[model samples]
Target: MRQHFFRCLKVKITKFIAAGMVVTCLFGSVSLGFAAPQPSPITILPIDRAKFVSGQLFDFLIEVKDADPDRIQVTVNGVTADKYFGKGAATDREASLATYRINNVAFKKPGKVEIAVKATGTAGLSTRTVKYDVVNPVAPKRAKNVILFVGDGMSLQARQMARILSQGITEGKYNDLLAMEKLSNTAIITTSGYDSLVTDSANSASAYATGHKAVVNAMGTYANSTADPFDDPNVENIVELVKRSRGMATGLVSTANITDATPAAMVAHTRKRAEQNFIAETMLDPRHRPDVILGGGSRHFLPLSTPGSKRTDNKNIIDEFKKLGYRFSGTKSELLATPPNTDKLLGLYQLDNMNVYLDREMLKNPKVLGGFDDQPTLMDMTQTAIDTLSKNPKGFFLMVEGASIDKQLHAMDWQRATYDTIELDKSIAIAKEFARKNKDTLIVVVADHAHGASITGTYHELDGKKGREAVRIYANAGWPTFADNDKDGFPDSPSPDITLAVQYANHPDYKEDYKFKAEPTVPAIMANNKAIANPQTSGEFYPGNIPSSDPSEVHSADDIILNADGPGADYFNGVMDNTEVFFGIVRALGLDGNRNVK
Candidate 1:
């Protein structure tokens, strides 16, 4: 009975197999009766033109399609990777995708870098080869200290206007040139970032300090697929590289908040410039901390319960710096009294942005000064910073920023802006005097961006008429009597009988009273997060011409002029990328890969 049952089961199985095969043949389908082999599915795009200096750190990325991360293989310059990317790579197993990010890798010898990547999966195989050309940088010859001066939001027109106002142009040529104009070399720098033609202060300054282009509002890091702002990969900054390699002192001085974009770019690496609290702490980090930090924004350093603190914790950065042997000063008298030989000096004079020159040192306007009665002048701050940093025997790198020029210009306060420009010139004059004495110091003056300001002749209110009808032009555009008999280098008052009737080429369609504002007026305000014409101004109602999203005057996508003096100045001429400024400064300081590489 058992034998009979076995025979019956075998006969049924044979019948079912034959029936299925006949059905497959009838449908014109055949099965191979074997599993298919997997194929590679990884590729790398060739870098036809990769611009980098020897020993410069850059990234290499690999993309694998339809493959597990564990199945991917990568080789650098034909070397068998023992450990790809140190440990491993990130992968999406269900999606059959993987990404390998290699950081701080560079070709020390100048040549072509060939990268090969292979990926295999159950579907198929893919392979890609990429070549990147590595060129050596020009070796340094004779310069030591490099000083970079940035005039925020200054443009060619701003420079021309400063020349006309300060040196007085009579019949086309009657006065001397401004100090910046007399530089040994001049270059027109293109200020666009990797993201847009128009760049903010942060990214542009980062490009100048680190020879890599970054996106708008980002500093020292590239935009990547990450939710955390601090986790993005970073490029080495001049402050870190110089101090680590040469043991040189680095100082950052600005009239704006110390945590503002331009100054903050030197040390902090973050995707967002508004991360003031994080940036302040980064400034205190021993590895990236600056030797001499003199500027405003003390509120971010103190904790919340400390009355005027802007921070959430009780870190007391002031106390931390004191513990670190930094001479902390909260007032001008303390700054002046501090001994010149002090190694590390940290000065924070105000809880916010220090008052501008017209308000703090000159006008003494209480409404504008806002009870922060005593603040250091640009001159005072520059002198103290120089005295402190110059003590380093290995030399120092100093970045001085004249910040409020753009702030006042955005408010349409031409007089205040001009005064701030004069103040910047004074600071440059001080740097030049120092550079003259110390021939090794390479000094550079440039602007991170430009504005829409122009000299459309001059404006005089003498016509007894108001608005555009009173605007002066041509021979009728007689010069206004702005006497500086005291030669203090500033007009006693901007409200003369004939004042500059400067009209903004692009602004909200508002009535023009053609008079100087006694107090700085808010040109625009925020309504539901959109920029609307400020109702605070005393004028006829005007609708805005720019996008409602913009709060005030926006940065123009115009090229800025750069002036340099000392050893490596010749490299900066005609049209050049903003990153070239970094290369020039590094060459001036003789920064070498062998010297700085760790």
Candidate 2:
């Protein structure tokens, strides 16, 4: 089921140990097996088998539960934490928990390292030892640019739907392939975070950005025992390493609000993904700020005095960006008018998440758009970002996201989701065209997570059947009538006779109309204290297969596809953990965060 974006911090009681420590050669989290050791009073951040880019800064933290604050000792190898790093650590004493933290630290060497912590609690002595690996990725031919395409919530089924709609099939043979499907290297990526079976975008993207797994509702930081979301142990992300270590340009583009999890995780560090106001402010920080920022959520950038502003302060972020010499564009027409030589850009086309391709470009109904009608397509934003960021001679890292694939799917609108998926495919084509000239660029197209939507068969009313009766299976299910005569890669119509019969593996109580919605809608809504069918559409009622409170389809724990080409693309093959994506990018770019700091 689509995870309800939890706004509060979850109280976690972890055992402080994995099944067993395993050697990590840039593969994934250190813990390989399923069995975790018994509980310990002291829990450490950056759990066992964690890998890091050499010199990649991270916060070392040990959370001691019901322990004496002064009786805790942490050591790196044989040396004390403070003595090992030659930097002082901070210790906070709370009512039932205490935290010992050393921030802004990095491993100088490329080898196995150990962190052992001991604490004296009321019950007895609690101790744990975890191993870590630090590596300086090297490549014979390094990449100059890395364009990471995150198709948020786009499952394997989602890709097939896009292929079926954009590149029609004849007699079970495909006419063509989506741009992302043509990549030279591919791997099936596992999406779960260490904390849960299924994962949210923030946690999953954190794996790609930081090469470390984070809990749900968090990105760029591990969950801490404290109540403060920002105080979580922060891990240095790819944008930070590229910009600080190599002076590389960084860009973030998405169809969702720029402050949303998938894009924000590239830079911001927070335990809670819902902290958009804080994430908006994080963009201004020079340490890890992007050179180009595009997408919706203008409300977070506008001042509190503004009509649609979602900010709580009077600071005008747009104006702040302008002061930093960023060219601002509030509409599609203005975005295209941006000078080709423009380097820094901050474009916010809508106050909230931009309209999906179906409603914005296809329907063009201003009423459904909530007043901010002039939004640019994901392809347009991606192109502008590339044009601006590629001006930097040191190279660049850009994350372009089709954010609404998951959103629409949560509402059970696969038609809208598939159209957006096509939009992402076209955006990938834009990056592919750029890579054609610059062979030094590495393009990775993948989904942060996946939905449960699946194509079961084709539905048609030709035989005077409706609803479930019209769902034709096996040989009876002919090719869908979706046609893309315009050759723009998008079907002419979202809904047509002989449309694919899509089914959700997991869903809340909802009505199944088996039709495309003219207006975006949720299949279920709250009634009394539980979720019930919306009553807006008519068909067979799908009794809640998932939790009633979910009110929509949920995210799947199933693995998603990863496609890549260009330099460092060879690193991807066979099944891999999600965190390996970060390692792959650094290897392609030859980025080593190891640095000499006093």
Candidate 3:
């Protein structure tokens, strides 16, 4: 049968090879052509196979390279694009690049939609076709509230380290599992974006927020040919969907700068996550503005005249939020004093990213914390957000992030990163307690991406073995003595006699002392435009494995773990794409985005 199948539908191999045609196997019919198909020069936004909730707004764009200025046609399904969108395209052309863009459009119905683009270029006619899926989740029992926890750079190892520190193991058995680990449903989540193998916090978080993949350094939008960051094709995120569809309150809480990549992705749409100043201003846009905002980036919200302000323009965003009836808080005391009736709250504790839990709370080092010592814990911030957002009968969607896990890992400070992971774990416990009282709440805990840190074994200088020699492996490795003496979940001391010997798989040239830094120090320093081991450690030097341009470790492409509880979490099972998280949240809330958009 196989011989007969190939013999009956055979192509002239010589003739097809003479042309640039590609031959098909027995399963496909052969097509003889002048050339094998080439990739289209025109690019469409939303990418191919994008999924969305019906009526979720997004910007559509067609970018053409080396094309004639006036020769471009776009169609949606079979209808002309402009007519289909009920508006004409805003065309822009510069040099060899031209674009046809339509902003703030949505599919009113649930089904598949095709976008076809054709442009006349010097290389002749260039055509492209892309399809999208629109869905409307009809739930049996809806969750009135949803809380997402992102532990940035928290890989499986990162989580395990937190577990070991917070809940010690005895004879190869853990005494207690983490609060997140106790979740009913869990999944191994793939964390790459469309453009890169390894993703940064912004791109991964954007996938979680918008149900669409974005490139590194970008969030809430797709990249376009133009250089403008804000003008990129925008996608409606979870924040916007919950707002217009269900009148749900929204909150974004983080330990990093409030306008940083992970937190900002929930609300801001930009091709560059570094646009912190603009992100701070975009929060004022009522169409998708969050009801509660908490974090450590007061600099971006302050006016340019303020000494530590990061904005170039003299825009006082904090004052603007005040005008909009938001009670402002700059310290833990102020946050705690916020009126219980205050539904709108804005808290920015530090001028920059907040210090890690270790440095801020336990170490009490004035040098590390500077003057901003009154910062709130992740648990307190999340509790405050839940309290304020729940005031709305419609419920809310809140995103809480442990921002320093990634930052400390980048600096190769495993001790600090592990403490932040514990902090995130404790915060998850708080959210779980809230969900217990309100059965209509869903809680999700996940990592934006993984770091390259790994545990070789335990390290100790007890036997006079020092540096690399002190690293114990196999039978010599004993359990780390990380005791939670006071029952606060955190180890009494991070520098136990036997401590985790965490090493980086991908790292810059750096010093290795087999000891935690008393104060956080850069693993590498720039010397003559190249990274070199820091001299502060006074230990053996290890050469960098990655490019010299990066003095810190980079994100790993490894799959991350996600745990969830309450309604609709069962949707997450087996191996899943990162974008599915957004769908899971929407499904749990029964958010119906199918509506008219004007």
The candidate maximizing TM-score is 3
lDDT of 3: 0.90
How would you encode candidate 3's per-residue C-alpha lDDT over 1-598 as one tens digit per residue? 6775576346456546656665554544445445646777888998999999878889998889988757889999999999998999988788988888889998888899999888998889988899999888755678999999999999999999999899999999999999999999999999999999999999999999999999999999999877899878899999888888888899999999999999999999999999999999999998779999999999999999999998998999999999999999999999999888999999999999998999989998998898988999998899899999999998999999999999999999999999999999999999999999999999999999999999999999999999899999998888998878899999999998999988999999998987888899989888899988887767778999999998888899999999999988778789999999999898899877774223
Runs of candidate 3 exceeding 4 Å displacement: 1-37, 596-598
Off by over 4 Å in 1: 1-50, 58-68, 71-98, 111-140, 505-514, 540-542, 596-598
Candidate 3 versus truth, CA RMSD in Å, comes to: 3.9
Q: RMSD per prediction, one decimal?
A: 13.7, 8.7, 3.9
Q: Which lDDT values do the candidates have, in the order given?
A: 0.75, 0.90, 0.90
lDDT tens digits, residue span 304-366, model 1: 889889898888888888899999888778888988569788888889887777787777888
